[model samples]
Target: MNKPIGDLHCHPSFKPCNNPDISDIWTYKKNIHPKDLFKGILGVSPRRWMVNLFVKDLATYTQSNLDSCYEGDNRLLFLSIYPIERQFLRPDRPFASSTFVQRFILAQVFGIELKRHIDSRIIQILTGFSSTKVVDYLKSVYDSEYVDYFKTDFSLEYKYINQSHLSCSPNAEDNVATFQLVSNYEEYAALRNQNIIAGILTVEGAHALGEYNSKDLVGDKMIDDLSEENKEKLKASFIRNISALKDKEQFEFTPFFITFAHHFNNLLTGHAKSFGEAKNKSMPGFSNVFNQKNGLDLGISDFGKQLIKSHLLSRHNGQRILIDTKHMSLQARNDYAAIVKALRDEGDAMPIVISHTAINGISTRAKAAERLDTNQLDKKSYVSRWDINITDEDIREVFDSNGIIGVCMHDGRMPGGKFKDLLKSYKKRWPQKEFISKLHTQMFLTNVFHIVKVNLDHIRTLNAQIPIEENRIPEVQAWKTICLGSDNDGIVDPFDNFNTASTLKDFKTRVKNAIDMNFDPLWKRFKILDIKEENYRFFNENEITELKLGLTSEEIVDRIFSDNIETFLSTYFVRAYLEGTEN
Candidate 1:
C-alpha cells in the first residue's frame, strides 16, 4: 500500500479560473469541448495540454487537479482560497503602445489596459501562453461596485468547490474519489480510512476579509484614504463577512486559518519582497510594477490590529482561525510575533503559522537585508535569500509554540543546492532514466535539509543554555515541525521532475532513497554556524556528531512527506470543547 501524502498549502481551484462551472477538478483532454477550442483561439481557456507537453518548465498547467491528487494518494490537502488580487492584473501604470500583440487584443476585448496595468513578468508571460480567463475575471471584478470584492470572489470559489462534489456518491464501490472539505481532524480521519481525498480550508490572505474596493485604486490606497464613515462601514462589512463564515450554514466548512499578507499590502499588514527578481536587469520593464515602497517595511495597520483582536483570533463557532505569516513584511512579522508572545504571556497560547515558506539561511530579517545589500550571503547557499522566506527567529518562535512549518515547493522560493550544476552534469553523462529522478530528488532535498538543519540548530542553542547535567531537547523532534506545502496551481514554477500533484507519489519514494544515499553530504552542507558569544554557546564536537546520526534516520523522510502533518492536525486542528458563541 502507498503512504498517503499531505500538502499544507495548494490551490486546487486556481487553474479552473476560466471555467468554474466545470464538473471535474482535473482538466482532461477529453473534457476539452469544441467551444473551448474556439475560446482557446480567442485567448480564453487556452489548451493547457500543449504547454504541459511542449514546455514543461513553463508550469502554466494546473498541478493540484483533483484527479492528480486522488491518484497520487495525496489525502490531506490544506487548500487555499485566494481571491485573486486585482492589483496583479491592473497595476498603477498604463500599457505602452509597443507592447505584446496579445495584450492589445486582450485590452480591446476586456476594455482595460493590457500593458499599463499588468504587474509581474510571470503573470504577463502566463497570460500570453495560457488562458485569458484570469484577466477577464479581473476586469469583471473591477466593473463590480461591491466594496468587498475579495469576499465575493472567496464565496464564489468556495461554492464552486462545494458544488463539484455533489455528483460524488461517497458510498459507491468504484475507483472514483471526491475532494470533500472537512471541518476538523475528526472528519479528515474518517475520510482517510475510506481512501477519500480530504481537504481542509485555508485562505491565503486577510484581504479575503473585505479589503478589496471596487474603485480600482492602487494597492490599499483606498483603505488609507477612506473617510471615517467609510472606514467604519468597511469594518462593519468585515465583521459581517467573517461572522457569516462561522454561522451554522458555513462554520463546519470555513477556513481554519487565513494568511495575514500576500503579494500586495492588504491594509492589514505590509508584505515581504515577493518580486525581487522582477527588479533584476533581465526584467527591467517590471522593475516598477510591483511597488512595495509605500509601506513596504512598515508594521501592521490599526485596522489590522482590531481585526485580529476582535475577530480572527477570537472564538467563531467555538473555534478560532489561526494567522499565517507567509508573505508578511519583516516589521509586520515582528509586530505580529510580539502579539503572539503577549497572548501567551496572558495565558492564551496561539499557534504561529507560516503556511508556505522557504528559509533565508539568515538569522534575522535585518541580517537578511544587510546580507543582500552587502552581497555577503554565502555564494554556495542554495536557498533564495529573499525576505519572503522565514528566518531563524521565525523557526525558533514556531518551535517554541509547537506550530508547524509547511515548507513550500516553488523553485523561485527554494532554489536547489550548490551541487545543482554537478547533478545536472551527472544526469547528462549517465543518460539513464533513473538519473533524471535522482537529479531532481537531490535538488529538492536541499530545501528539506535546510529547514531541518535550522530547527536542529535552534534546539541545540536551547540545549547549550542548560548545563550538561540537565535535560535537553531531543534532536529528532525538529523533524516533526517540517512538512510539505507545495503551492501548486498558485502560479509557481515547479521543479521539472515533480511538476504536478500526480508526480508526488513517485517523488515520495525517490525522496526516501535520496535521503539514504545522500545523508552525509546533506548533513555537512547544512552545518550549524556559530552564534554570537553573548547570545549562545557553540555546539561541541560530540553534540554535532550525535545530532548528525539522529537526523539520518529514514523516519525523518516519512515525517516530511506525511507523519508530521498528521501529528500536527491531531493536536491543533480541533474546535474548542466549550459551548460556542457567535462571532
Candidate 2:
C-alpha cells in the first residue's frame, strides 16, 4: 500500500491554465504511421519518445483532471479556491492585449482562450477594473460552467457528488478516489480513517471579497474618500461574501486562511514584489506592470487594520479564519507579527503561518540596518531586492507563536541558490548527455535532500551561537517546522524529477535513501565538533536508539509528510473549543 501524504498548499481547481487538452497533439503524433517516418523531422530514439510520451504524461498530471489525484495517494489537500486575476483577460497591455497574434498565443499555446468567447466590449470593460468586477466575472463562470465540469470529471460510480456539500465521502470502490470537505481536525481525522481525501479550503487572495483593486485611484487616500453610505455598502459586501463561504446549508467552503495579497495589491493589504506578465517576453504586446507602483512597499493601511479588527479576527459561525503571510510585503509582515503578538499579550492567541516560503538566512541585524523607505527609490529599484523569503527572526516568531511554515516546492523558492551548486557538481561528474539524462530522474530528489541538510545545518549553527540555557529549542523541533506545500498548478515551474502530483509517491524512497547516505557522516562531524566544546552532552539514549535502529528516518519522513501538519491543524482548530463559541 502506498503511504498517504499531505500537501498544505496546492491549486487543484486551476485547470484552465494547465489544460490537459494541450497534450492531444503529441498523442496524435505518436499514432502516425510507421512511427519512424518522422525520425528526421523529429529527433530519433529516446528524444522522440520523450517528446511524444513523456509530454502527454506531463499534461495529464499537470491539470486537476481528477485522475491526477488518484495517480498518487494524496490524502490531505489544502485546496486553494482561487478567482483567476482579471489581468489575464483584460484587453490592454498592463492587463492583457487583444491583438491577433497575442490572442493566438494565448489560445494555442497558453490555453487561456476563454476571453475569446466573451464579447469584446465586456472584455474591454474588465480591463483595468476593480477586483470586485473581476471576482464577479469569475463567479459567474464558476457557477455556470466550471462547477459542472469538475463534477463530471470527478464523479464516482456514475453518481455525482454535490459540490455544495459541507462534507462528502464519495464511494471509492470504482478505482476512483473520494473527496471530503474537512474544516476542523476532527473531520480531517475521521475522513482519513475512512481513507478518503480530506480537502481543506483556502482562498488565494482577499480580492475575492469583491471591494478592492490594486490600481484604484485612491492611492494613499486609504478609504477616507468613501462616503458613509458607500462605506456601509462595502462592508455589507464583505460580510455577505464571508457569510456565503460559511453557509453550511449552501456552499460550505469557508477558508481556513486567506492570502490577503497576491500579484497585485488589494484593499486589504500591501503586497511584496511579484513578476509581471512582461516576464514572458514572447507576449511583448502585454505589459507586465500591474500594481507595481502603488502597493509595493507600503505596510498595512489604517483601513486594513480596521477590517482585521472588525471582520477578519472575528468569529464566523464559531470559527475564525486565519491569515496567510505568503505574499505580504516585508513591512506588512512585521506589522502583522506585531499585531498577533499584541493580541497574544492581551490573552488572545492566534497562530501565524506562511503557507509557502523559503528561508533567506538574513540576519536580524542586517535586515534592520537596511532602509525600507520606498518613496525615495524608483518603482523598479526594489523589485530585485525585495525579500520575500522568511528570515531568522521571522522563523523564531513563527516558532514562538506555535505556527507552521510550509516549504514551497518551486525551483525559485525551495533550493534557491543550492540548485545551481548541485547542477555544477553533477555536470562536472557526468559530462555526457546520456549520463545527464539518467541523472535527471534523481535531480529533484537530490535537491530536496540538500535543502533539508542545509536547513538542519543552519539550525545547528544557530544553536552553537546561542547559549544552550538561553535557547532551549531542540534541533528536532525545528525540523518539524518544515512541511510540504507543493504549489502545483499555481503557474509554477515544477522540479524536474518531481514534476507532478504522481511523482510524490516515489519521493518516499528518495527521502529514505538520502537519510541513509548522510546519517553516518553527519553524526561523525557532530561528534568531532562536540570534542572541542565545554559542557558537551552526548546524544541521548533515545536519540541513539532512534538513529541506530532506523526509527529516525521513519519519524522524520512521517513528520514531513503528514504528522506535523496534522498536529498544526489540531492545534489551530482546538482554539475554538477552548474559547467560548460565538453565537
Candidate 3:
C-alpha cells in the first residue's frame, strides 16, 4: 500500500454555486441515480462518469470534495479558508447578468439554472455592493451557527471522520479513519498515530480579514490628504479584524498561515503579477480583469509593515501565525525576507514559507533580468520574474530558515514546455472536440513527471551551493523540503491527469514510474556539476553517515508524498510551543 498523502494547500469551500447548502449539492453527487443505468452497464457509476466527463469545477472533483478524500486515501489536507472576492460575481459578467440571452449562456456553459427571482435589478444591487458589505457577508458565514452546521453536516455524512474533533479517538472498526483539525504538532501527531486524516487550517488571502477597503484607502492615499478621524477609524478596523481572527470561539477558525496577497491587490500587501486574460477568461466577470494598476509592482506599504509587526510577527496568547509568501510581489517578498532576517538578527526564528509554489532556477535579480533582457527566459524563469513562482534565492532563504516549501501541482507552475505543443496536437487531431480524448491525461502525467525532475534538480543545485564540509547538507535534507500542496479548488488549472483530488492515487504510481526511469541519469548529471573542492575539505563524521544512507528513489518519493512535510510541521510547531513562541 502507498503511504498516505497530504496536500499542504487546497480550498474545499470555494464552490461555484451560490447556494448556502453547497455541501448538499456535493453530497447529492454520491447518491445513486437512475442515470447510472447506462454507466452501470460499463461498470462505471453515473457520478464518476459525470465527474470524468463534464465537471470542470474543482469542488465537484473527487479528491477536492469532502467525501472523496477517504476514497482517494488522502489522509491529510491543509484546508485553505477563503472568502470569495466580489469582483468575480459582479452583475456585469455574462453569467451573472439576468438577461435571457446571458442566462442561456450561463446555463449552457456552467450548467447553472437561473431562477426568475434573480433578475437584472438584483444582480445590479449585488454588483454595486461595497467590499465592506461583502466582508460582512463573509463574516456571517464564518459565524458560529454556520461553522457548527458545516462541521456537523460533514461529520454526519462521513461517519468515519469527525470534523469537529482536534485529536483522533480510536475507532472500533479497523478500516475507519478519523478526520480531525490539528492546531499544533502534538495534535497532528496524535491524530496521525491513530490513522486520522488531519486537516490544517490556513487562510488563502488576508482580504478575508475585512480590512480590504480600509487597507486599499491607506495604500492609495497620502497621509496629508486623509482626515485624522478617518485614519483612526481605519486603524481601529484593522485591529478589530485581527482580533476577530484570533477569537477562536467566535469564528471557530485560526489559520496556521495567511497568504498575504492573492489574485487581487489586498490592502495589506502588493500582489505578484498573476494577471492574464488566458487564466481568468473562463470565470465570469474576470475576462478583462488585470492586477497591473492595483498594487502590482508595488511592495508592502507602511501600514502593511505595521500590520505585520503587530499581528503576524507578534505572538498572541503565546502563539504567532506565520505569513505565507505565495502571492506577494517580488519587491514585497524581498521586503518580507529582509524584515524576517532583521528579526532573526534580533534573536527571533520566524521562518519563511512559500506555501505552494514551483521553482525557477534563477537565484538573483541580475540573472533573471539578464535572461529577460535577451528574451532567453525559459517558461519557469518568466514565471519567476512575474513573481508567481520562486527563485533559487528564495529557496535558499527558506532552507536557511528551516522552513518547508510546498510544491504546487498546477500545470502553469509545473516544469515542461509541452502543454502548448500538446494543445496544438489535440486541436489538430480532434478539431470538432474541445480536447482530444485521453491526451489531457497524458499531458498531465508528463507535466507532473517534469515537475518532480525539476524539484530534484533544484535540490541538487542547492546542495552544490552549500559548503560541503560545513554541514554538507545531505541530498535527503533538501529532498525533505519538497511536498505536495496541490492548489485544488483554489481557482487553479489543475494538471489534467491529476485533475481532481481523487486522482492523486494514480499520480503516486506515475511518480514512482518516472523516478525509476529518470533518477539514475539525473543523479549522474548532478555528480558531475563543477564545484570547488575546498567546500569538502573537512567533511565531518555526521556528514559521512548521511552520505552512506544516500536516499533511494522510493524513499525520496515517500518523503515528498508524506514524511517530509509531516516532519516539518512536527519540528516547527512543536519547537514553537516548547520555546514559548506559540500562543
- Candidate 1 vs. true structure, TM-score: 0.80
Report how far residue 50 has shifted in candidate 2, in Å.
22
For 445-533, candidate 3 gives per-residue lDDT tens digits of: 33223333334456667668777656655544555566778887666556655667766776766565544443244332111111111
lDDT of each: 0.64, 0.51, 0.52
What is the descending TM-score order?
1, 3, 2
Give the clashing pairs for model 1: 93-116, 94-116, 95-115, 95-116
- Number of the top TM-score candidate: 1
TM-score of each: 0.80, 0.66, 0.68
Candidate 3 residue runs with Cα over 4 Å from true position: 16-18, 24-63, 91-175, 212-230, 247-253, 278-287, 290-292, 365-385, 412-418, 423-471, 519-549, 575-583
lDDT of 1 by residue, 169-229 (tens): 3333554666677887777777766757788889987777784445523534535457676
Reference-based lDDT, residue 331, model 3: 75
Runs of candidate 1 with Cα error greater than 4 angstroms are 17-22, 27-57, 91-136, 141-147, 166-174, 215-225, 276-295, 316-318, 371-380, 416-436, 464-472, 519-553, 577-583
Root-mean-square deviation of every model: 6.2, 10.2, 10.0
The order by descending lDDT is 1, 3, 2
Pairwise TM-score winner, candidates 1 and 3 = 1
